[model samples]
Target: MCEANAYLIEGDDKNLIMEAVDTIEPDGDNLLICNIFGEQKVVKASIHSLSLVDHKIYLKG
Candidate 1:
């Protein structure tokens, strides 16, 4: 329940990147995201904002 959904922010749009992300780690210029299902992804984006109350993680690419 503590896991958050990840989104990518570009201009005035938001794109859902991952659902139920368990972790977000900084690796050079990329953001590594891992989900509850053990799926993982590395994106070239930085954290833009977090909406913990809504269980969301926003990133800027």
Candidate 2:
């Protein structure tokens, strides 16, 4: 279904911030997101890198 999950990294801890994300867009030190159910969310953080492998979104710092 091409559904993606968003995760936020905190030191040595990782947290699942959002799920069923339709897409992700970076804006400065934040992220603009559109969810599967047609919901929008904004996260304030610094994005290190973005990759898609096997239809999964990996946010790494």
Candidate 3:
């Protein structure tokens, strides 16, 4: 329940990258995101901002 949704921000647009993200780890130059359901993703992006109240994690590539 404490998990957050991940978003990829580009310009003025924000795109949903992952949902119910449980963990995020650094993997070389990329980032590894894991969901509550065991789904995983590797994104070549950097963290932009976090909206804890909204449970959102924003990233920029």
Candidate 4:
């Protein structure tokens, strides 16, 4: 329930990358995201901002 949805931010657009992301781990120059359903994704991006109230995690690539 504390998990947050992940987004990739580009200029004025925000793209949803993953939902219900349970964990985010650093992988060299990339990030490893794991969802509640066991789905995983590796993205070459950096953390931009976090909206705890909205349960959102934004990243910049």
Candidate 5:
């Protein structure tokens, strides 16, 4: 319930990367995201902003 969905901003569009994201770790220049379902993704992007109220995680590549 405390998890958030992750998105990658691409110009005028926002792409959903992962849902129910439970953990995020800094992996060098990239980011490592892990969902509650144990799904993992390594994205070459940076943290753009976080909307806690909206339950959203925004990343900029």
Candidate 6:
């Protein structure tokens, strides 16, 4: 199974915005993420550095 999570660092706080996710992308000031339930989430990108691994976005501090 392919399980994933979205983690972001904002200022001095690190947060886990979601779990069991699928994909993520950079959209303007936010990161667009697709959850395991096929739901779309738009979160602020100011918190962390977004990295693309094997075409998947991994948000890191």
- Which candidate has the top score in lDDT? 5
lDDT (tens digit, per residue) of candidate 6 on 2-30: 75666675667656777777776778977
Model 4 residue pairs with clashes: none
> Which stretches in model 2 have alpha-carbon errors above 4 Å?
49-61
Best by TM-score: 5
Report the lDDT tens digits of candidate 2 across residue range 1-61: 7776777777886677777878778877778878889888778865554444543454554
Question: Regarding lDDT, does 1 or 6 come out ahead?
Answer: 1
Displacement of residue 16 (Cα, Å) in model 5 is: 0.2
Steric clash pairs (candidate 5): none
What C-alpha lDDT values do all the predictions have? Answer: 0.94, 0.70, 0.94, 0.94, 0.96, 0.64
User: Residue-pair clashes per candidate, as listed?
Assistant: 0, 0, 0, 0, 0, 2
Poorest stretch of ten by lDDT in candidate 1: 8-17
Alpha carbon deviation, residue 52, candidate 4 (Å): 1.2
Which residue pairs overlap in candidate 2's backbone? none
- Find the number of clashing residue pairs for candidate 5: 0
In candidate 3, stretches whose alpha carbon ends up further than 4 angstroms from where it belongs are: none
User: Estimated TM-score per prediction?
Assistant: 0.94, 0.67, 0.95, 0.93, 0.95, 0.59
Residue 59 lDDT in model 6? 60
Q: Give one digit per residue, the lDDT tens place, for model 1 in 18-57.
A: 9999999999999899999999999999998999889999
Instruction: Give candidate 1's error at residue 28 in angstroms.
Output: 1.2
Which 10-residue window in model 2 sums to the lowest lDDT? Answer: 49-58
Model 6, residue 5: distance off in Å is 1.2
